[model samples]
Target: MAEDVQINWGKVKNIFESVTERMGQNPDRPAIGAPKAKVRVIKERLFEAKAEGHTFQIDEPVERGGNGLAPSPMAYFTAGAAACLTSHITQSAGFLETHYTSLEVEATVLWDNRRKFSIADLAQASLGIIYNIHMESDEPEDKLIALLKHAEDGCYASDVVRNETPLRAHLIVNGDEMYVHKNGAEIPDVPAGPTFGDNPTGMSKDEIAAKKRDGG
Candidate 1:
């Protein structure tokens, strides 16, 4: 059992059962959620955003014409994906009783101006942002692989990244509606990337016990 994952296994099963029962009773009960961010531009390439009562600053690098006081917009996007994967892994490990110590997920996003900002290329490039995810864990090989598969399949962030979602743009000029762009397309979803191979660390509990006994 990993100490860092402090989920109460005793209640997890009950909670899951309750959720299942509720869904069965009310099939149309919607799971509602929305994320709101209020961004105020401070200067060219710099802005401050408030979301969920938390405030954060975002800025481009000096070369991009900002003070570089904080992470770029892309950094936040990548970080969100990493955070989602980490949370799912922790929850799955606890729920499934998968033995493990520590777990870490690193996400790298690849995108270029041509692919992201160019109107001509946007329609053609299905993969505006390609990401690679790497996982590190000390659990048994099979257990780790199972955990990874579960997280990959169920993580909302990864699913959003992998699938394409449309965006609607509303443009206003002098308080008058200037344009409304309904052009929307799905964004590519992220896929499983490289991972540490089977028993990469070879630190399973039984192996550790044997090593201690051998004392060689």
Candidate 2:
């Protein structure tokens, strides 16, 4: 029944109208600020970060002289990009009044540590972090593509990953460089098997099925 329910078209229209009118009249009134995070070193290769009352731990692996207690900082960075992109995709869907039975985003990082000889190489060696974003949604192909494009265009995390922001290394915070590298030879040309019934682009068989079963 939930999947069968239609989006509130009237509310969607009103929201668009109100947003446009407000932006046109007072463009400078709604100034959004970037989020900030503060971290304190707990011990060797371990730290605690606080952001908006939420606290989390960051640590390196046991092989890296850490206790292997919490996820490494790189894991958090990968997750943040995925989370931000998902948020943007959902926001775009809502703005367009699109309905879906389920939506999911997965991010994978390809890290090359060949040049990781010392801390000094962090800024240059770690520059080869590549992200693979895979999303699954039970929406039409056109709408889903549009949503993904909108998210990619506006997602702050993606922008940061794309190196669109300025960076500086300080004693307080370390500077890192990351760039996405695409190699056609390493990528598959097509899906290995038949497309999933729910997600045409990419999704496992266990993923959510389309609300309305359409021809695949």
Candidate 3:
């Protein structure tokens, strides 16, 4: 049998209560955070991204003109939304002192790619996302439903998809400001940087092993 997952309800409840109390004292208090990611293209349809001290690679499938070395950007986006909802559900359950044997969340993203490839002008690229929650618990059905509702309301990723969020895009070419979508203006181009060389051939197995052995 698999070991049961454990959570400290007392700690969870205390955290929620403390945050609520703080917010109640200052209703207009702003809690803003900006997470940043630096991405660089490695080759066609392949990129490396560094965020929060972690680095990861993103690539498209072989059919999409990539080497199929990693998951695509859409995969990460879908996973982020699903994971956010699952996190909220788990945290809310702990806060409410609800018990559960297992919890699983499955997500499906319906998308149209006609506009992406400039083949046709579509109404929207993302049709919708469906999330299915499979949870095993002895709790009352009403309680479970309430928990789901709370999680849906609190999930930021779900809100982003459901609401119209303004996006400001800017393009910088070779360290020169090229365009700003917010103002719908193109800036005068400056001297361009040095042209890029051929794509790098990564280390071989022997070199990688030697580096590992040398603690590099």
Candidate 4:
């Protein structure tokens, strides 16, 4: 069993208040952060990733051509969003001087695998996401509701989901730039990868068992 963890709300409140005061004085100051991740393929459906001096592995399930040794990418994606919102809510509660015994956040993402497997293109890969927050506290309902609203508005992950973000892809092959893709626009005279024709064949059960035995 895990031990109970305690938080110093006084310190949290002081830090938040000091940051707010400084930001208020320099309203136009720009604060920016660029978080980067480097991923390398370990096998057919297994990968290793490094970010912020931390390393982790990502693997698909047996049906997705992997040994199922680690959490899938989608799991990380959903958890990241949930964790971001939870952090914001905790900080907001501290700044508001609200007391809570426990807080929990759950996130779910609806997905359609047909498009991913080339079975159909009628639906998107990710349909939508739902978030539920539960808190045990003696604070008034209205005050808690207000704090939730403020935290939701300030959550970076929520903002990313609610807004449209542009993505640019640069393809490199054999140490040369092949093409740059932006907004699904075609690049003239650029070679394209093979089209999806059939579903991928995953690892066999015997292979998965052997991988597990080897502590993969």
- The candidate that wins on TM-score is 3
Order the numbered candidates by TM-score, best leading. 3, 4, 1, 2
- Compose the digit string of candidate 3's lDDT tens values, residues 1-216: 234657666766675666666556757744333456898999989999999679999999999889999999989889989999988888788777775778778888998889789898886799999998888889998899888988899888899899776566779899998986763345343234321111012345698689779865
Give the local distance difference test score of model 4.
Answer: 0.76
Error of 2 at 73 (Å): 0.5
lDDT of each: 0.66, 0.63, 0.76, 0.76
Write model 4 residue lDDT over 1-216, tens digit each, in one string. Answer: 223336778867876776666556757744343456888999988999999679999999998788999999988889998998988888898898886778888999888889878999764577777999977888999999998998899888888777665557889999999997786444343223321111012335697679679864
Q: Residue by residue across 1-216, what tens digits does model 2's lDDT show?
A: 223434454554464555556556756543243456998899999999999669999999999889999999988988887788867666666777664545556677665475575535444444433445454447788887786787678788777666645444334225644544553234323334442211322333444355224422
- TM-score for all predictions? 0.68, 0.61, 0.78, 0.76
Stretches off by above 4 angstroms in model 3 are 1-3, 183-216
Error of 3 at 125 (Å): 1.3
Which parts of model 1 have CA positions greater than 4 angstroms off? 1-21, 116-139, 172-178, 185-216
Global fold similarity of model 3 (TM-score): 0.78
| Of 2 and 3, the candidate ranking higher by TM-score | 3
